[model samples]
Target: MKSPSRTILIGGTLSAALTAPVVAAAAPATMDVTITIPQLKVAEYHRPYVAIWVEKAGTPPKTVAVWYDDDMQKNEGTKWLRDVRQWWRASGRTMKFPANGISGATRAPGAQKISFSRAQLGATAAGEYTLVIEAAREVGGRELLRIPFSWPAKAGAGGRAAGKTELGAVTIAFR
Candidate 1:
Protein backbone atom coordinates (compact mmCIF):
# COMPACT_ATOMS: atom_id res chain seq x y z
CA MET A 1 0.00 0.00 0.00
CA LYS A 2 1.19 3.56 -0.84
CA SER A 3 0.15 6.84 0.84
CA PRO A 4 -1.57 9.49 -1.34
CA SER A 5 0.26 12.85 -1.94
CA ARG A 6 -1.43 15.96 -0.50
CA THR A 7 -1.08 19.58 -1.72
CA ILE A 8 -1.72 22.71 0.43
CA LEU A 9 -2.49 26.19 -1.02
CA ILE A 10 -1.42 29.36 0.90
CA GLY A 11 -3.75 31.49 -1.29
CA GLY A 12 -3.73 35.19 -0.22
CA THR A 13 -0.83 34.66 2.18
CA LEU A 14 1.48 33.57 -0.62
CA SER A 15 0.32 36.42 -2.88
CA ALA A 16 0.81 39.04 -0.17
CA ALA A 17 4.27 37.78 0.62
CA LEU A 18 5.31 38.10 -3.00
CA THR A 19 3.75 41.57 -3.41
CA ALA A 20 5.17 43.10 -0.22
CA PRO A 21 8.00 45.55 -0.88
CA VAL A 22 11.40 44.46 0.32
CA VAL A 23 13.19 46.89 2.56
CA ALA A 24 16.95 46.65 2.61
CA ALA A 25 18.64 47.31 5.90
CA ALA A 26 20.06 50.80 6.10
CA ALA A 27 23.82 51.26 6.29
CA PRO A 28 25.21 52.61 9.51
CA ALA A 29 25.96 56.34 9.49
CA THR A 30 29.58 57.24 9.98
CA MET A 31 31.65 60.42 9.87
CA ASP A 32 35.33 61.33 9.82
CA VAL A 33 36.59 64.73 11.03
CA THR A 34 39.99 66.30 10.59
CA ILE A 35 41.43 69.57 11.95
CA THR A 36 44.78 71.24 11.72
CA ILE A 37 46.55 73.13 14.50
CA PRO A 38 48.94 75.32 12.55
CA GLN A 39 52.33 75.72 14.22
CA LEU A 40 52.67 79.39 15.06
CA LYS A 41 55.64 81.67 15.54
CA VAL A 42 54.93 83.89 18.51
CA ALA A 43 56.58 85.13 21.69
CA GLU A 44 54.35 82.77 23.70
CA TYR A 45 52.75 79.67 22.26
CA HIS A 46 50.21 77.61 24.17
CA ARG A 47 48.35 74.61 22.86
CA PRO A 48 44.94 75.71 21.66
CA TYR A 49 41.84 74.41 23.36
CA VAL A 50 39.61 73.07 20.60
CA ALA A 51 35.93 72.13 20.30
CA ILE A 52 34.11 70.42 17.45
CA TRP A 53 30.32 70.29 17.18
CA VAL A 54 27.33 70.16 14.85
CA GLU A 55 24.16 72.23 14.92
CA LYS A 56 20.91 72.54 13.02
CA ALA A 57 18.73 75.57 12.96
CA GLY A 58 16.51 75.97 16.04
CA THR A 59 18.21 73.08 17.87
CA PRO A 60 20.90 72.69 20.47
CA PRO A 61 24.39 71.87 19.29
CA LYS A 62 25.90 68.38 19.57
CA THR A 63 29.52 68.38 20.61
CA VAL A 64 31.67 65.74 18.90
CA ALA A 65 35.10 66.39 20.39
CA VAL A 66 36.89 68.68 22.85
CA TRP A 67 40.66 68.85 23.18
CA TYR A 68 42.14 70.67 26.14
CA ASP A 69 44.60 70.38 29.01
CA ASP A 70 43.40 67.26 30.80
CA ASP A 71 46.45 66.70 33.00
CA MET A 72 46.14 69.72 35.23
CA GLN A 73 46.03 69.30 38.99
CA LYS A 74 42.62 69.53 40.72
CA ASN A 75 41.02 69.18 37.31
CA GLU A 76 41.89 72.78 36.62
CA GLY A 77 41.87 72.18 32.91
CA THR A 78 38.09 72.38 32.79
CA LYS A 79 38.08 76.00 33.94
CA TRP A 80 39.60 77.15 30.68
CA LEU A 81 37.21 75.27 28.44
CA ARG A 82 35.13 78.40 28.46
CA ASP A 83 37.87 80.13 26.55
CA VAL A 84 36.51 78.41 23.48
CA ARG A 85 33.73 81.00 23.75
CA GLN A 86 31.34 79.94 21.02
CA TRP A 87 31.31 76.33 22.14
CA TRP A 88 31.03 77.25 25.82
CA ARG A 89 28.03 79.45 25.10
CA ALA A 90 26.40 76.95 22.77
CA SER A 91 26.75 73.61 24.64
CA GLY A 92 29.87 73.30 26.77
CA ARG A 93 28.49 75.15 29.80
CA THR A 94 25.76 72.54 30.21
CA MET A 95 28.14 69.57 30.03
CA LYS A 96 30.27 68.06 32.76
CA PHE A 97 34.03 67.97 32.44
CA PRO A 98 36.03 65.00 31.18
CA ALA A 99 33.12 63.72 29.14
CA ASN A 100 33.96 60.17 28.06
CA GLY A 101 35.06 59.66 24.44
CA ILE A 102 34.55 63.38 23.69
CA SER A 103 37.31 64.83 25.86
CA GLY A 104 41.02 64.31 25.25
CA ALA A 105 44.40 65.94 25.62
CA THR A 106 45.29 68.69 23.15
CA ARG A 107 46.94 67.51 19.93
CA ALA A 108 50.17 68.69 18.33
CA PRO A 109 50.35 71.15 15.40
CA GLY A 110 49.27 68.97 12.49
CA ALA A 111 46.28 67.15 11.10
CA GLN A 112 44.32 65.42 13.88
CA LYS A 113 41.63 62.97 12.86
CA ILE A 114 38.65 61.42 14.64
CA SER A 115 35.80 59.22 13.52
CA PHE A 116 32.18 58.85 14.77
CA SER A 117 29.48 56.27 14.23
CA ARG A 118 25.72 56.67 14.35
CA ALA A 119 25.63 55.81 18.02
CA GLN A 120 28.24 58.41 18.83
CA LEU A 121 26.18 61.09 17.08
CA GLY A 122 23.05 60.31 19.11
CA ALA A 123 19.59 60.97 17.62
CA THR A 124 20.21 63.15 14.60
CA ALA A 125 17.41 64.16 12.28
CA ALA A 126 17.85 64.03 8.50
CA GLY A 127 18.42 67.63 7.46
CA GLU A 128 20.92 70.43 7.04
CA TYR A 129 23.63 70.92 9.66
CA THR A 130 26.78 72.91 10.22
CA LEU A 131 30.08 71.60 11.59
CA VAL A 132 31.71 74.16 13.83
CA ILE A 133 35.32 74.05 15.00
CA GLU A 134 36.59 76.61 17.49
CA ALA A 135 40.08 77.02 18.92
CA ALA A 136 41.43 79.35 21.60
CA ARG A 137 44.89 79.59 23.08
CA GLU A 138 46.32 81.52 25.98
CA VAL A 139 47.96 84.76 24.87
CA GLY A 140 46.86 83.88 21.34
CA GLY A 141 43.99 84.85 19.01
CA ARG A 142 40.83 82.75 18.74
CA GLU A 143 39.49 81.28 15.51
CA LEU A 144 36.28 79.49 14.54
CA LEU A 145 35.31 77.80 11.29
CA ARG A 146 32.01 76.37 10.04
CA ILE A 147 31.27 73.84 7.31
CA PRO A 148 27.75 72.98 6.14
CA PHE A 149 26.61 69.42 5.39
CA SER A 150 23.52 67.25 5.29
CA TRP A 151 22.60 64.49 7.73
CA PRO A 152 22.22 60.83 6.74
CA ALA A 153 25.13 62.02 4.70
CA LYS A 154 25.81 60.70 1.22
CA ALA A 155 28.87 58.47 0.91
CA GLY A 156 32.05 60.41 0.13
CA ALA A 157 30.16 63.66 0.86
CA GLY A 158 32.28 66.20 2.71
CA GLY A 159 33.16 69.85 3.33
CA ARG A 160 36.11 71.99 4.41
CA ALA A 161 36.89 75.38 5.93
CA ALA A 162 40.05 77.29 6.74
CA GLY A 163 40.86 79.31 9.84
CA LYS A 164 43.23 82.24 9.92
CA THR A 165 44.84 82.67 13.35
CA GLU A 166 44.39 79.99 15.97
CA LEU A 167 43.27 77.09 13.78
CA GLY A 168 44.11 75.84 10.29
CA ALA A 169 42.28 73.64 7.80
CA VAL A 170 39.19 71.85 9.11
CA THR A 171 37.43 69.12 7.20
CA ILE A 172 34.49 66.71 7.66
CA ALA A 173 33.47 63.66 5.65
CA PHE A 174 30.69 61.08 5.72
CA ARG A 175 31.11 57.37 5.06
Candidate 2:
Protein backbone atom coordinates (compact mmCIF):
# COMPACT_ATOMS: atom_id res chain seq x y z
CA MET A 1 0.00 0.00 0.00
CA LYS A 2 1.23 3.54 -0.76
CA SER A 3 1.92 5.98 2.07
CA PRO A 4 -0.32 9.10 2.43
CA SER A 5 2.54 11.37 1.27
CA ARG A 6 3.13 9.21 -1.83
CA THR A 7 -0.58 9.28 -2.73
CA ILE A 8 -0.65 13.11 -2.50
CA LEU A 9 2.43 13.37 -4.73
CA ILE A 10 0.80 11.11 -7.37
CA GLY A 11 -2.40 13.16 -7.19
CA GLY A 12 -0.43 16.36 -7.74
CA THR A 13 1.32 14.92 -10.79
CA LEU A 14 -2.04 13.85 -12.29
CA SER A 15 -3.47 17.30 -11.65
CA ALA A 16 -0.62 18.95 -13.57
CA ALA A 17 -1.02 16.50 -16.44
CA LEU A 18 -4.71 17.36 -16.74
CA THR A 19 -4.04 21.12 -16.85
CA ALA A 20 -1.19 20.93 -19.36
CA PRO A 21 -3.49 20.52 -22.35
CA VAL A 22 -5.69 23.39 -21.28
CA VAL A 23 -2.65 25.69 -21.21
CA ALA A 24 -1.46 24.46 -24.55
CA ALA A 25 -4.88 24.99 -26.06
CA ALA A 26 -4.81 28.60 -24.92
CA ALA A 27 -1.66 29.43 -26.87
CA PRO A 28 -1.79 32.16 -29.51
CA ALA A 29 -3.47 31.31 -32.81
CA THR A 30 -2.00 31.52 -36.30
CA MET A 31 -3.41 33.55 -39.20
CA ASP A 32 -3.17 32.19 -42.72
CA VAL A 33 -3.54 34.47 -45.73
CA THR A 34 -4.24 33.33 -49.28
CA ILE A 35 -3.67 35.87 -52.04
CA THR A 36 -5.06 35.12 -55.48
CA ILE A 37 -3.45 36.72 -58.51
CA PRO A 38 -5.93 36.48 -61.37
CA GLN A 39 -4.80 35.61 -64.86
CA LEU A 40 -5.12 38.80 -66.85
CA LYS A 41 -5.73 38.79 -70.55
CA VAL A 42 -3.07 41.21 -71.65
CA ALA A 43 -0.29 41.36 -74.25
CA GLU A 44 2.32 42.17 -71.59
CA TYR A 45 1.61 40.53 -68.25
CA HIS A 46 3.96 41.24 -65.33
CA ARG A 47 3.53 39.58 -61.98
CA PRO A 48 2.18 42.22 -59.62
CA TYR A 49 4.13 43.62 -56.68
CA VAL A 50 2.12 42.87 -53.56
CA ALA A 51 1.98 44.01 -49.95
CA ILE A 52 0.03 42.37 -47.13
CA TRP A 53 -0.54 44.06 -43.79
CA VAL A 54 -2.92 44.41 -40.87
CA GLU A 55 -4.29 47.63 -39.36
CA LYS A 56 -6.11 48.55 -36.20
CA ALA A 57 -7.70 51.82 -35.15
CA GLY A 58 -5.21 54.39 -33.87
CA THR A 59 -2.34 51.97 -34.35
CA PRO A 60 0.36 51.70 -36.96
CA PRO A 61 -0.13 49.11 -39.67
CA LYS A 62 1.76 45.83 -39.28
CA THR A 63 3.22 44.57 -42.53
CA VAL A 64 3.16 40.80 -42.93
CA ALA A 65 4.58 40.39 -46.43
CA VAL A 66 5.99 42.35 -49.36
CA TRP A 67 6.31 40.58 -52.70
CA TYR A 68 8.57 42.40 -55.14
CA ASP A 69 11.36 41.84 -57.67
CA ASP A 70 14.23 41.00 -55.35
CA ASP A 71 16.46 40.05 -58.27
CA MET A 72 17.10 43.59 -59.44
CA GLN A 73 20.63 45.00 -59.30
CA LYS A 74 21.53 47.36 -56.42
CA ASN A 75 18.12 46.59 -54.94
CA GLU A 76 16.58 48.68 -57.69
CA GLY A 77 13.43 46.68 -57.12
CA THR A 78 12.59 48.83 -54.12
CA LYS A 79 12.15 51.88 -56.34
CA TRP A 80 8.98 50.46 -57.83
CA LEU A 81 7.45 49.46 -54.51
CA ARG A 82 5.80 52.87 -54.51
CA ASP A 83 3.45 51.59 -57.20
CA VAL A 84 1.54 49.87 -54.43
CA ARG A 85 0.50 53.35 -53.28
CA GLN A 86 -1.45 52.78 -50.09
CA TRP A 87 1.06 50.41 -48.59
CA TRP A 88 3.99 52.51 -49.73
CA ARG A 89 2.53 55.54 -48.05
CA ALA A 90 1.57 53.70 -44.89
CA SER A 91 4.56 51.43 -44.22
CA GLY A 92 6.87 50.67 -47.12
CA ARG A 93 8.75 53.94 -47.46
CA THR A 94 9.81 53.86 -43.84
CA MET A 95 11.06 50.29 -44.03
CA LYS A 96 14.36 49.02 -45.38
CA PHE A 97 14.19 47.08 -48.61
CA PRO A 98 14.18 43.28 -48.49
CA ALA A 99 12.93 43.26 -44.94
CA ASN A 100 13.93 39.99 -43.33
CA GLY A 101 11.22 37.35 -43.11
CA ILE A 102 8.78 39.85 -44.64
CA SER A 103 10.12 40.28 -48.18
CA GLY A 104 9.98 37.84 -51.07
CA ALA A 105 9.87 37.64 -54.86
CA THR A 106 6.75 38.48 -56.86
CA ARG A 107 4.42 35.57 -57.52
CA ALA A 108 2.93 34.23 -60.74
CA PRO A 109 -0.75 34.37 -61.64
CA GLY A 110 -2.11 32.01 -59.01
CA ALA A 111 -2.90 31.65 -55.35
CA GLN A 112 0.00 32.60 -53.03
CA LYS A 113 -0.26 31.88 -49.34
CA ILE A 114 1.53 33.31 -46.25
CA SER A 115 0.92 32.34 -42.66
CA PHE A 116 1.53 34.36 -39.50
CA SER A 117 1.56 33.31 -35.87
CA ARG A 118 -0.03 35.75 -33.42
CA ALA A 119 3.50 36.70 -32.37
CA GLN A 120 4.72 37.21 -35.94
CA LEU A 121 1.70 39.47 -36.57
CA GLY A 122 2.41 41.55 -33.42
CA ALA A 123 -1.32 41.89 -32.84
CA THR A 124 -1.28 41.60 -29.09
CA ALA A 125 -4.50 43.42 -28.37
CA ALA A 126 -7.78 41.58 -28.75
CA GLY A 127 -10.05 43.63 -30.97
CA GLU A 128 -11.03 44.44 -34.53
CA TYR A 129 -8.34 44.52 -37.21
CA THR A 130 -8.32 44.76 -40.98
CA LEU A 131 -6.22 42.72 -43.38
CA VAL A 132 -5.08 44.80 -46.37
CA ILE A 133 -3.67 43.43 -49.60
CA GLU A 134 -2.47 45.76 -52.35
CA ALA A 135 -1.12 44.77 -55.73
CA ALA A 136 0.41 46.75 -58.59
CA ARG A 137 1.87 45.64 -61.89
CA GLU A 138 4.11 47.43 -64.35
CA VAL A 139 2.00 48.90 -67.15
CA GLY A 140 -1.00 47.36 -65.37
CA GLY A 141 -3.65 48.52 -62.92
CA ARG A 142 -3.34 48.47 -59.12
CA GLU A 143 -5.88 47.02 -56.71
CA LEU A 144 -6.30 46.86 -52.93
CA LEU A 145 -8.65 44.74 -50.83
CA ARG A 146 -9.43 44.82 -47.12
CA ILE A 147 -10.90 42.11 -44.89
CA PRO A 148 -11.83 42.76 -41.27
CA PHE A 149 -11.34 40.25 -38.46
CA SER A 150 -10.95 40.07 -34.70
CA TRP A 151 -7.94 39.18 -32.59
CA PRO A 152 -7.85 36.04 -30.36
CA ALA A 153 -10.09 34.88 -33.16
CA LYS A 154 -13.58 33.59 -32.58
CA ALA A 155 -14.50 30.05 -33.54
CA GLY A 156 -14.80 29.70 -37.31
CA ALA A 157 -13.74 33.33 -37.78
CA GLY A 158 -12.40 34.42 -41.16
CA GLY A 159 -13.06 36.78 -44.12
CA ARG A 160 -12.68 37.17 -47.90
CA ALA A 161 -12.48 39.98 -50.45
CA ALA A 162 -12.52 39.92 -54.24
CA GLY A 163 -10.57 42.27 -56.49
CA LYS A 164 -11.50 43.21 -60.05
CA THR A 165 -8.14 44.14 -61.50
CA GLU A 166 -4.68 43.07 -60.43
CA LEU A 167 -5.93 40.70 -57.75
CA GLY A 168 -8.46 37.89 -57.37
CA ALA A 169 -10.17 36.49 -54.27
CA VAL A 170 -8.09 37.11 -51.11
CA THR A 171 -8.90 35.16 -47.97
CA ILE A 172 -7.86 35.21 -44.30
CA ALA A 173 -8.26 32.15 -42.10
CA PHE A 174 -7.48 31.69 -38.39
CA ARG A 175 -6.10 28.42 -37.11
Candidate 3:
Protein backbone atom coordinates (compact mmCIF):
# COMPACT_ATOMS: atom_id res chain seq x y z
CA MET A 1 0.00 0.00 0.00
CA LYS A 2 1.16 3.55 -0.79
CA SER A 3 0.84 6.69 1.33
CA PRO A 4 -1.79 9.22 0.09
CA SER A 5 0.90 11.88 -0.64
CA ARG A 6 3.03 9.42 -2.62
CA THR A 7 0.02 8.27 -4.64
CA ILE A 8 -0.86 11.87 -5.53
CA LEU A 9 2.70 12.64 -6.71
CA ILE A 10 2.81 9.51 -8.87
CA GLY A 11 -0.52 10.36 -10.46
CA GLY A 12 0.61 13.89 -11.27
CA THR A 13 3.85 12.66 -12.87
CA LEU A 14 2.00 10.16 -15.01
CA SER A 15 -0.44 12.81 -16.19
CA ALA A 16 2.36 15.13 -17.30
CA ALA A 17 4.12 12.37 -19.19
CA LEU A 18 0.93 11.45 -21.03
CA THR A 19 0.21 15.04 -22.12
CA ALA A 20 3.79 15.99 -23.08
CA PRO A 21 3.56 14.90 -26.71
CA VAL A 22 0.29 16.73 -27.29
CA VAL A 23 1.70 19.91 -25.83
CA ALA A 24 4.87 19.67 -27.90
CA ALA A 25 2.94 19.07 -31.12
CA ALA A 26 0.80 22.12 -30.55
CA ALA A 27 3.86 24.34 -30.06
CA PRO A 28 4.98 25.43 -33.51
CA ALA A 29 8.08 27.24 -34.68
CA THR A 30 8.17 30.21 -37.03
CA MET A 31 8.99 30.05 -40.74
CA ASP A 32 9.77 33.13 -42.78
CA VAL A 33 8.93 33.37 -46.50
CA THR A 34 10.06 36.19 -48.73
CA ILE A 35 8.64 36.88 -52.18
CA THR A 36 9.93 39.49 -54.58
CA ILE A 37 7.80 40.91 -57.38
CA PRO A 38 9.82 42.65 -60.06
CA GLN A 39 8.96 45.92 -61.70
CA LEU A 40 8.59 45.23 -65.41
CA LYS A 41 8.91 47.79 -68.15
CA VAL A 42 5.79 47.37 -70.24
CA ALA A 43 3.04 49.29 -71.98
CA GLU A 44 0.66 48.53 -69.11
CA TYR A 45 1.62 46.87 -65.85
CA HIS A 46 -0.71 45.72 -63.12
CA ARG A 47 0.17 44.35 -59.73
CA PRO A 48 0.16 40.58 -60.01
CA TYR A 49 -2.06 38.32 -57.93
CA VAL A 50 0.07 35.73 -56.16
CA ALA A 51 -0.64 32.46 -54.41
CA ILE A 52 1.67 30.55 -52.08
CA TRP A 53 1.14 26.97 -50.98
CA VAL A 54 2.78 23.77 -49.75
CA GLU A 55 2.52 20.30 -51.28
CA LYS A 56 3.66 16.93 -50.05
CA ALA A 57 3.82 13.60 -51.81
CA GLY A 58 0.46 11.92 -52.39
CA THR A 59 -1.36 14.79 -50.70
CA PRO A 60 -3.23 17.71 -52.20
CA PRO A 61 -1.65 21.14 -52.00
CA LYS A 62 -2.44 23.29 -48.98
CA THR A 63 -2.61 27.06 -49.39
CA VAL A 64 -0.32 29.01 -47.08
CA ALA A 65 -1.05 32.47 -48.43
CA VAL A 66 -2.72 34.35 -51.27
CA TRP A 67 -2.39 37.96 -52.44
CA TYR A 68 -5.05 39.55 -54.58
CA ASP A 69 -6.99 42.77 -55.05
CA ASP A 70 -8.87 43.06 -51.79
CA ASP A 71 -10.16 46.58 -52.43
CA MET A 72 -12.57 45.90 -55.25
CA GLN A 73 -16.26 46.69 -54.86
CA LYS A 74 -18.51 43.92 -53.48
CA ASN A 75 -15.57 41.49 -53.36
CA GLU A 76 -15.53 41.22 -57.12
CA GLY A 77 -11.75 41.20 -57.09
CA THR A 78 -11.68 37.54 -56.18
CA LYS A 79 -13.24 36.57 -59.48
CA TRP A 80 -10.03 37.35 -61.34
CA LEU A 81 -7.84 35.46 -58.89
CA ARG A 82 -8.54 32.30 -60.87
CA ASP A 83 -5.98 33.53 -63.37
CA VAL A 84 -3.46 31.97 -61.04
CA ARG A 85 -4.51 28.78 -62.78
CA GLN A 86 -2.61 26.12 -60.91
CA TRP A 87 -3.43 27.31 -57.45
CA TRP A 88 -7.06 27.81 -58.34
CA ARG A 89 -7.45 24.27 -59.56
CA ALA A 90 -5.43 22.78 -56.76
CA SER A 91 -6.96 24.42 -53.71
CA GLY A 92 -8.29 27.88 -54.39
CA ARG A 93 -11.79 27.33 -55.73
CA THR A 94 -12.83 25.30 -52.72
CA MET A 95 -11.94 27.89 -50.12
CA LYS A 96 -14.19 30.79 -49.18
CA PHE A 97 -13.04 34.26 -50.05
CA PRO A 98 -11.05 36.52 -47.73
CA ALA A 99 -9.54 33.73 -45.69
CA ASN A 100 -8.07 34.95 -42.44
CA GLY A 101 -4.25 35.06 -42.30
CA ILE A 102 -4.05 33.73 -45.89
CA SER A 103 -5.57 36.50 -47.96
CA GLY A 104 -4.30 40.04 -48.48
CA ALA A 105 -4.00 42.79 -51.06
CA THR A 106 -1.59 42.49 -53.95
CA ARG A 107 1.82 43.91 -53.13
CA ALA A 108 3.94 46.34 -55.07
CA PRO A 109 7.15 45.48 -56.92
CA GLY A 110 9.53 44.49 -54.11
CA ALA A 111 10.35 41.82 -51.63
CA GLN A 112 7.56 41.00 -49.19
CA LYS A 113 8.06 38.95 -46.06
CA ILE A 114 5.44 36.67 -44.47
CA SER A 115 5.68 34.41 -41.48
CA PHE A 116 3.83 31.23 -40.51
CA SER A 117 3.77 29.06 -37.43
CA ARG A 118 3.43 25.29 -37.40
CA ALA A 119 -0.11 25.60 -36.11
CA GLN A 120 -0.96 27.88 -39.01
CA LEU A 121 0.41 25.28 -41.44
CA GLY A 122 -2.26 22.79 -40.38
CA ALA A 123 -0.81 19.42 -39.41
CA THR A 124 2.61 19.81 -40.92
CA ALA A 125 4.36 16.52 -40.35
CA ALA A 126 8.10 15.95 -40.65
CA GLY A 127 8.83 15.17 -44.28
CA GLU A 128 9.72 16.57 -47.69
CA TYR A 129 7.49 19.32 -49.06
CA THR A 130 7.45 21.80 -51.91
CA LEU A 131 6.77 25.51 -51.60
CA VAL A 132 4.96 26.78 -54.68
CA ILE A 133 4.36 30.36 -55.74
CA GLU A 134 2.32 31.41 -58.73
CA ALA A 135 1.62 34.89 -60.04
CA ALA A 136 -0.58 36.29 -62.78
CA ARG A 137 -0.99 39.86 -63.89
CA GLU A 138 -3.68 41.66 -65.82
CA VAL A 139 -2.61 41.95 -69.49
CA GLY A 140 0.69 40.27 -68.51
CA GLY A 141 2.01 36.74 -68.49
CA ARG A 142 1.78 34.17 -65.70
CA GLU A 143 4.59 32.40 -63.87
CA LEU A 144 4.97 29.59 -61.37
CA LEU A 145 7.97 28.90 -59.12
CA ARG A 146 8.64 26.03 -56.74
CA ILE A 147 11.23 25.37 -54.07
CA PRO A 148 11.61 22.05 -52.30
CA PHE A 149 12.60 21.72 -48.63
CA SER A 150 12.22 19.45 -45.68
CA TRP A 151 9.82 20.07 -42.83
CA PRO A 152 11.04 20.38 -39.27
CA ALA A 153 13.91 21.93 -41.16
CA LYS A 154 17.41 21.83 -39.78
CA ALA A 155 19.35 24.94 -38.85
CA GLY A 156 20.82 26.99 -41.71
CA ALA A 157 18.42 25.37 -44.19
CA GLY A 158 17.03 27.59 -46.91
CA GLY A 159 16.45 27.84 -50.67
CA ARG A 160 15.61 30.34 -53.43
CA ALA A 161 13.94 30.32 -56.86
CA ALA A 162 13.39 32.96 -59.52
CA GLY A 163 11.06 33.65 -62.40
CA LYS A 164 11.92 35.27 -65.67
CA THR A 165 9.16 37.82 -66.16
CA GLU A 166 6.46 37.94 -63.54
CA LEU A 167 8.20 36.97 -60.30
CA GLY A 168 11.58 38.22 -59.17
CA ALA A 169 12.93 35.95 -56.43
CA VAL A 170 11.38 33.73 -53.77
CA THR A 171 13.16 32.49 -50.67
CA ILE A 172 12.33 30.36 -47.62
CA ALA A 173 14.25 30.23 -44.35
CA PHE A 174 13.75 28.05 -41.32
CA ARG A 175 15.12 28.93 -37.94
TM-score for each of the candidates: 0.81, 0.84, 0.81
Candidate lDDT scores, in order, read 0.77, 0.81, 0.79
Q: Ranking by TM-score, best first?
A: 2, 3, 1
lDDT of model number 2: 0.81
Q: Which candidate is the best by lDDT?
A: 2
Instruction: Single out the weakest 10-residue window by summed lDDT for candidate 1.
Output: 1-10
Residue 55 C-alpha lDDT in model 2: 90
The top-ranked prediction according to TM-score is 2
Compute the lDDT for candidate 3: 0.79
Flag clash pairs in model 2: none
Clashes of 2: 0
Question: For model 3, how does the per-residue alpha-carbon lDDT over 73-99 read when each residue is reduced to its tens digit?
Answer: 999999898999999999999998888
- lDDT of candidate 2 over 29-119, digit per residue (tens): 5677888999989999889999998899999898888999998999998889999999999988889888876888899988887777665
Candidate 3: pairs in clash: none
Cα displacement (Å) at residue 111, model 1: 0.6
Q: 1-175 in candidate 1: lDDT tens per residue?
A: 0011001113322343466523112332567788889999999888999998888888889997898998899999998899999999999999988886688888889999877654455425777888889999988889999998876676674899998888888887765
Where model 1 places Cα greater than 4 Å from the true spot, the runs are: 1-28
